[model samples]
Target chain A: MSITREEVLKMAELARLEFSEEELDGFTAQFQGILDYIEQLRQVDVEGVEPTSHVSLSADFDPRMFREDEARESLPVEEALGGAPDPAAGHFRVPKVL
Target chain B: MSLRRIEEADPALGAFLTCDPGRVLERAERVDRDVKERPLPLAGVPVAVKDNICTRGLRTTCGSRMLEQYVPPYSATAIERLEAAGAVVVGKVNCDEFAMGSSTENSALQVTRNPYDLDRVPGGSSGGSAVAVAAGMAALALGSETGGSVRQPASFCNVVGLKPTYGRISRYGLVAFASSLDCIAPLGNSPRDIALLLGRIAGRDPLDSTSAPAPVPDYVAELDRPPGRLRLGVPKEYFGQGLDPEVKAAVEAGIRNAGKLGCDVVEVSLPHTRFAIADYYIIAPAEASSNLARYDGVKYGFRAEAPEDLMDMYRRTRTLGFGPEVRRRIMIGTYALSSGYYDAYYGRAMKVRTLIRRDYERAFEKVDALLGPVSPTAAFRIGEKASDPLSMYLSDIYTVTANLAGIPAVSVPCGFTAGGLPIGMQILGNLFQELPLLRLAQAYIREFPVAPPPLRV
Candidate 1:
């Protein structure tokens, strides 16, 4: 039920986040407490129980009726990039990857 | 008038995060122009929107530093509908960062205080919205509930709050939190007001594929029907451990009052109630981990200043941008959905979720609606449960079931504690049965008229 510091670090890396040493310690401790609380679910016998991925508990849910596929106008480039911290040539500017 | 009221009360309550007077005036002028030609339902009524719900030209912060200056290009379908119904968008209000926490204290932007008493916390991530309505800053407010965000705050603030059946309201343009569980809801002074707001916003949208195509009911019209000979279930689990005695007494009195009004109040059981908090934690975080991956440095939102590489940029931006609670949830979700632990955590939680939903289905068979306390306790003081995450999560014990089952639920002011803090009575209805829920709530509100909090500007 305990999450180790190494495991926390691994999860943090997967989540694209980094923490300071002090924060890592605090998070590891808190994660352990939360996991311990959540471990109570293990006691329940979920034999043959179908997993509910969504709350469409009603019987009328149909997956086939998607919106019609059609071309439509999109946000103009200026509005789309309005909140961007760095915008150049009508695109979001990020650090060089190559 | 609402702008003046908000300007006066906001200094004391910290309810609003942003208020653009220019936009407010312009919207009011438009409503004025259209009033003569086309009479609207909510003509010139000001509304406070939770910052997570997108507004076309206004900054949608989600109470996070990540999107502090991010103005959405498009508004949420609910907001569009509200505006079309003549509700004026007053301002964006504060909330927990990414709607992660139970309290507004987690908001990276501002600390929203309870209007009832400034010392206590306004139950949140919709704290600001609830405070706005309770303090008379706005006529109505919009709140998004992932767990008990809307109802619990409504309970604490002594106002009416409603979370409709999942997919009942379109989620298009709502900033995603936990996609499966998040719901756009409302807070108001009365069930009729909540019904009016619900009627306007509840409907299918082509933009959101998950929005149910069912025809929206006339919630306002339906409120006129008298609820006669109703069967209300009192869950055995809700009255048990961890419930504040005053809150339990108040809710029980409300149930007895229902019995006096000819409701057939009966005892029922939801055996899987204990597993709800655990199930919610696992599922919400798992989905949030995936949904929040979009806030990388490349897209709009806060980006770390200088980065060595793309990977580093992503890591540093998120690390610095998100508050502690958001990072913790993302980490928990990432760990749960990780390759090795997926089955033990996320998969198992989903199965438990099915059992929780089945519990409601079984209970609803014997009753027209379920009655309980919206929150285990009334509003606790600020910073009381902030340090302990598990205790804070436990505050949502009674309210998460409706979201899990996708049933309509409303929180109505029942009574108050000795200290004068308000307690709420929650009435839950079957899937898409919002009409009966509102009728029952209207009956209760009619009998016991809840007074507004004593925080007049």
Candidate 2:
């Protein structure tokens, strides 16, 4: 169950994070420990048990109570873009992807 | 008055991350003016909120550098309700970075110390909220519990923490960690205070679809009736190894006292209890990985100065913004949900979660409630478990089951350890049975009568 350096790198990439060489080394070791600990789950016999995605739904939960799918007022553009790091004319600015 | 007290006391405790006296005074004055005509349940009471819950126009950091200056545009439904009830917002308290760790040590902003012993941690990620109540800085506090965040800290600080059934309270503006497990809870000095806060905040919200449409009960009124011959289950797995002997003794004494109070204590088994941590780690991170993907550099929060490309910006921003613990969790979650490994990790964890839930269902069939220790031991020194993450995760063994089962649970001060640190006993009830849970806690508190932490500024 030990995770490799390549695997850690892949995970960091997938998570949109970068690690230094020292941090990568440390994380590799720690991930091994955590994964090993998590490996204990394999011991449980989960043959036909249904996976529970939401604990609140096991008993009394309803979906029909959700708000009607009618159109509603949304946040004003200025308020919506208030926290943006870089903003153009009524839009969030990001680095060129093309 | 509360601001003055907090100003004098909070420097010693490091409980609050942000406090606005101007806003608080304005709110208090409005409450005073309104109260002459109609009664407000929490009129003029000062309430501190955990930094993770959103408050309009205030910085809600979630104790992370990423959100160091992030001000939420709208308030949480819980906070709106509390404010309507005339509770004054004191400030936003500290917590672990995104409520990830068991101790407040993981806070990227600052460490919140235990009010009882400055050398020890106040438990987390609701550490600051618990400390605020324990030190009399605020009359009540709002804390979110993904695992044992609320109850564990309440145990450490000798306060009352109530985590109602999942979806009992709205999670509209709560910064999501583990969506299925997260619950907005209340921490206070007394069960009555906790009940009052819970009654005000517990109900369905159109904003959060997951919130249950169940009718809110008069939790404060529920305390009047003496709990009559209630069947209490003592889960055998909780009393097993790794439990501090002092905590075990205190909880057992509390159980015995419950028997004296006409509660029929019986031994019960939750056989799949051992797998909770593993299951939790997998499922929580899997959800977190999805939830936190919104924190890229473009829209909000901290962004790196400049980057060669968008991908580099994203990587650098996340790496520098999040702390080690958060990064570790993200990595674990990403791996779990990755293409080749989803079934082996996240899928298996989900099945185990079902087994854990079933165990609680079976136990509740014969018993009205279950009782156990809130944490394995009393509060540890600040840096005691910082190096060992697994050991830190294990400390939440007894408390996480309630969250896993989506049941209502409360922690009330049972006794003090030999070292003079406080120990709390947890009472768990079936889904949406918060009234009975609060009643049981109130009765125990009446008998034990916990003393406030001796924090003199």
lDDT of the candidates, in the order given: 0.90, 0.91
DockQ (C-alpha based) per candidate is 0.81, 0.86
lDDT of 2 by residue, B89-114 (tens): 89999999999988899999997888
- State the weakest 10-residue window (summed lDDT) of model 1 chain B: B448-457
lDDT for position A51 in model 1: 94
CAPRI class of candidate 1: high
The runs of at least 3 residues in candidate 2 whose Cα sits more than 4 Å from the true structure, single-residue gaps closed, are B451-453
Predicted structure 1, TM vs. truth: 0.98
**What TM-score against the true fold does each predicted structure earn?**
0.98, 0.99
**Residue B129 of candidate 2: its Cα lDDT?**
93
